[model samples]
Target chain A: MALTDRCDIFGSVHEKGINRIVRHLMRQRPSLFNYGTAFFLRNPNLLCERIQAAPEVLQAHDPLLSVQDPVPILGAAIPLGLNWCLQFTDLQIDFHPGNVFHLPNELGNLPAQRLALRMRGCFGLDCPSEEFIREILPQVEAEEVAQRGKEVFGTKERQPAAPEREPIVLPTRKLQCLCVELFAVLHFEWGTIPGNPQQWLKLRLDGLEIVDLGPAPLEEMAECYIRAVLKLGILPRLSVPIEAMVLNITELMRKQGLAIGETITLQPTPVPAGVPNNPAVEDDRLKAFINLVVEV
Target chain B: MAHFTLAVSEGTFRRSFDLLKRNLRFSKSDQASFGIFVAGYDVRAHLEGGTLDLRADNTISVRELDIRWDRLRFTLGINIPEICVGGGCINMPWPIPDICLPRVCVFSGNPDISISPDLAAFVAQEVSFTGRVVARYFDASVPPPLPDLCAPIRIEPLPDHNQWHIHIDPQTIDVDLFDFPDIVGNLIENTLSNAVRAIIPGGFVRDIILAIIGGIADFIRFLLDIPDEIDEWLSDLFNVSFGLLDFIGTLVLDFFSTCNPIYRIDDPFELLPASNGLIPVRIPLRNLSVRVNDAEMVAEVDIGG
Candidate 1:
């Protein structure tokens, strides 16, 4: 029951070949793997201080949670300082019989094929102290209060507010290094993407496992975050458009002045294990089967 | 081991061969003179019906491939010897002197009679060959040399590619001589006899002249210098005198080698298409080789950076 037994054509890319592609893509397109947010700090010390020092900690009004707001939180204009950043580099990939990262028992037991990825980077978050928040909040509230009064009274004349405070410089620690390793099982499905009529051989992330996260709860959270990133941000890039794989014999014949009105398409065929050259994740090779179909 | 390898099953190879066969065509016209008698042929033939075998020894064996004649016209030129009658000097008395009678000649001189008859439907040829599939890399950057215009026959041009050309390198080729039916001999004899008879007198005179000629068929066979079996003679006329066999062999060789390739693969194989203004991803191919097993023809290639 090997993959070749059920398929008319079979192909495989070895681990070395895969690694070569990964290296080229990672170097040329670094932005694909790196992400960061200014508010979400990677440094736990600063993040804790910002949360504890806030004045309205218990009754804080989150713009995101407001249902009846005039402007949506995403579209609303908000002024924020850039204080945190995360960047991943030195990304590496490996096919199963895992080498770079170990697969957990749950992931290892899965019947699906899998691959592991290891990446290392650094991130940092900066949060203002209690004194700085107290000083900044009142000035911001006073300016807002004056702006509201003018709008309520229907005044056309300009109104002068209190003098602006000088910019304050806060001391912060350097970014801390972080290493992440993840294992994901692979799944193959045939479907079409929205807005595109052509079919595609899609490679989907069946499952995700974050390796060595130290604690169970933290590992669970990290797994969820990484899964979302991989599923939404990365897997789509790997989906192969079936139209690209078609042999296009009709067009070639037309070029040669042959009027055979038949087209040959290279379609992926199902493969079962134990077949010679079976399409599977084994011996560090990702193999698949393809067959040619003629359409008139 | 290469980064990528593709194996085409024998069934698939046969499909490609069939396509090539469908498009294959060969037509030639040539004339040659053997002493006083001249022979010529205009032939148009095509390939059909062959058993394609992929051998484990890494060669392809094509057996009994029929070369079907679409149009085959054989032309023969025979120079009739002088035929004369009633020519002699009448003996006269010495004093009266000799008086001579004029010679009555059937023809003014040696006349060359030409006969062009279509023998295509009656004749056929079979060819067998064994060859290995060889892969040749074509570099598109370099221009190909100009063709030899002065040559008797010009070979078809090949693509100066960025392509992997798969050609059949023939090791051995066997082409059968053109086989003619027994009726072909009679057909030619009758045509020549009628042509000769047309110029002679009719009725009693014609019969006497034909009898003197000693059977028009025998007369023609003697003039053409042919054996008793007209079919065998005709076969030799076309095969050896006309050099049709040699022409066919060379044509077959050129057809399989340079004129057409069994398969072609682009050198820089495109794996992904350009999208959203991004350049297409292409991998360079190198060291492409082909081998045939009992079940399939395997082509192996290495990926270049």
Candidate 2:
């Protein structure tokens, strides 16, 4: 989710609150939520069942959501898993897990209005009793967390020492699967990219990426290109051609609206080798795809 | 000099073997069973997949068998799986730690429990072994003149078992109704002929001569326990000299005028009655396939390569 939405939904926890949480989690988990991670399994407030119901929720005439509305309530269901199913309340949940994030392409419209089909290992949720976590939390609880906070500051052994284990600070995440906070807004509109004149363009912001479906109207006789994303419950074992994924993203954007006048300069990420550049090489092998985006 | 009569067709021959295999149970009364294992008195697990080294002072009979042929598929895609025949002698030597150590000290005579031994004389017989060959027709393209289930030839145990021999009796076949002896004889002859041709082509030109030469090669190779590497090497040179003899034999079979002015060389039955004049090549020719009538053993046999 976008930082603002993440902050609001996480109870007005602004960038400062997030920084504090991250620092605390890092102190607890170490390096994981810090720079060591290439991916982050966010468990932020969502349920597996609700994620499954999201497609129907949107098709039922989506309600216009304000910038502050919780993402799952705004006709867009942010995918989450059951394991690491943390909850401030029954409604507020977190699916983030040990140090990992998905690739932007793998996000598969989880931030879009559709079913949250997973393309990775199922964050299998056994839902350990809250009583269990609470019981384990107090066992051998220590005082004073020897961390940078104490060493950097002059406050020596004062009052009740912070638990020996630092108040958890998530490890530094060097990279992310999706644009975690790259975008500014969370609304969508159909527009036109001048280059692709005949196709209607779709531009959406989940406060992370400015997702654009290319300007395309199949033919004068065809219906609007209907696209949906689904998540599988397991980590997908797929060998994908990055080139195909890139082409797919570009094509989707072109159809939505080649209407954006400004050039969208995208960075070139390295594509793994042996994945055939030709999509047709594996056109029918959808099972091999760990995650997928279907556009009808 | 001797003719033997034994009647068992290929189908009956195979069925008998199968029934015997299924019925034969390992006998506990067999002394070779528990002799050597008790002697080990200090091995954990026992009786696993390994060789049994049978050694004696005067002589050592060792079989470093690395395999059981149950999984080995034959060229004909037939498999007569390996079944434990029986060959272990377990003997425990007494005296050891009275407790756990001694119990473990005794060789694990169980098949599931593995036992390791450096040198065991009366090595506990775990499982016995038997050799088998999956018999399949060489060629199926040609329609069988008679029902294949009733193979004219039956398994006849040879009187002189040490030399290792099998009798191919085709007399039981219907000479008129089916005319299968001709085909059976041809299969045997052609198989021999091919073996000769493979050994030294142009050496055995005529079928009869080829059969004679092939038989000699078989006796020298298999019956006498000669290595094929040496047999093959000798055959190349041996065939040249034998080739001259083969040519002369063919001439005799064709001209000797003992049975008739001329006899058809098409079927083996044709050569049967003419055994009277086979005085010269008789001993050798019959080695490939022979018919001898003596008071004790009246038989027609082939010493297989």
Candidate 3:
């Protein structure tokens, strides 16, 4: 048989085992996936006027801003703010049935594998509100008019007084069952961590697809954001340090007082094809093959 | 299929076996006094030149592993019979005074001649056996029992923890009897003769003493109670009388099975080292088993969660 058909050392972990590991990562390292960003409105007049005519703009809705406070915009003089944050809690990962993680058949195509990850969690998002923008429109308009007056007449002018507006505090709207299905081709890299020569195995995001994100524009934006986070933030931390896997049999023997010169070096080898229950193609397990080299 | 599997080719296994053999050392001394003669030996031997064959039947055949004796000092002590003459008085010529002779002795008393000939590099034996590879689990939690002083071979127990010990369990051992060369018998005889000659007078007196004791070789042989072939006799003396054969066989068995394990793997085998305050990842090994084939030896194990 070919070397690719057999291995000196073989090891595999079941899908259940992978799920357990995922759960552990989620519990111990939650900061990897939970993040937020804010957007400040440059002009609040446009949105403020629209909210004032329609009070229902402040109500909770999907794919749109959800207002925490539904109070009417008494005066359009308050400055408006828009910010969004996503916090995921109780996150769980599932490798959908019949869709297993597996290595490509060709060795040249190695380091790349196909996998699908379906993540479900309690997702919370702090979205932009129309009422807050409407409340701050009058102040923004007065400031703009004064700026124009200064440019044309070159004189200081007093603006009309307006009622003070309370600062809008948008509450995070939480969804109990927010599901994200990711179909991606993952590539693996084996190298030492920078500044530390310990061997590590890391998986990189090569290609990604968001199965459903409503429309084309939304899907594209979601895919770009998720891909960036996975590539730059989460994937790098998913390394498995394998320095300990290279067992020094000679050293162990010497420690036991057996004087021997031969050393057993185990290095990761390509997972052989056509093996029964191949870890890569088999959805049930994740497996690895190692080549053993005895050095004198 | 097991969670983990490891296959070691025959060539690799031989390398490991050679290392183990090189590190193994056996040194022991014993003595026994049996009425007329006393015999003892202080020996040190090492294993070398073994043919290790992995068989298709899942057994290992070890043949001709020479037990090379580095030091083989055989000590013998024998009490020689005393020789005295000329002590009685003789009457002659009717009433003329009797003539009396003073006693002459070959030795002051019955001497016990002890001889330790240079028996250093000639004694050797071959040990052969067929065995199956077996694994034993050592549990560190339980306290070990007290040592058995009366056991055939006593091994000092070392503290072991949760480890899988792989041993070659011999089914039967066939150890060749120690074979001494003809020169060894001559060496012993010459030493004994020299020791006796050193204690006795030379010239006519020595001749007279020789005549009285019959041939010196005969006398020594009679004292040792051995047949004509001294080398065969000496071989028997070591192999049977002194129980060296049984001792060697038992020693080999105990050495491989109890004193040392061919291979050992610690339970909860550490796969990663602890760094940055994180605990090392260790996977517990379970149901470990080993088997031998014509091409290789294989070990299969499961990982405990």
Candidate 1: tens digits of C-alpha lDDT, residues A1-296 = 32233445557666666555554443333334334432232333442212221122123321111011111122111232434444554555566666644556767643536655555544444555667667666756776787678788977355665365433333344333445555667656667899998877677787777667768999898888878888898888888886676667667777877665456556655333324333466656677666756665
Error of 1 at B192 (Å): 25
Which regions of candidate 1 are displaced past 4 Å? A1-8, A28-101, A104-106, A109-179, A189-206, A212-218, A225-256, A260-278, A290-296, B15-46, B69-127, B135-168, B174-287
lDDT of 1 at A126: 50
Ten contiguous residues with the weakest lDDT in model 1 chain A: A62-71
Candidate 3 true-interface contact recovery: 0.15
lDDT string for model 3 (B101-122, tens) is 9999764432267788755555
Better of 1 and 2 by DockQ: 1
lDDT of 3 at B47: 82
Q: iRMS for model 3?
A: 10.6
TM-score of 3: 0.46
Output the better candidate (2/3) by TM-score.
3
Query: Please, what are the lDDT tens digits per residue for candidate 3 over residues A1-296?
Result: 32223555556555555554444433333333343322212212222111121122123111112223332333433443333333333332222232334322221122324334544323333344467446655767896776777658855444454466555544323222244555555645567777988767778666666655578899789888988999998998787777656777667767887656567666665323424322342334455666566766
Docking quality of model 2: it rates as incorrect
Order of all candidates by DockQ, from best down to worst? 3, 1, 2
Candidate achieving higher TM-score, 1 or 2: 1
How closely does chain A match the true chain A in each prediction, as TM-score?
0.56, 0.16, 0.47
Q: Scored by Cα lDDT, where does model 1 land?
A: 0.59
Look at candidate 1 and tell me the lDDT of residue B2.
Answer: 55
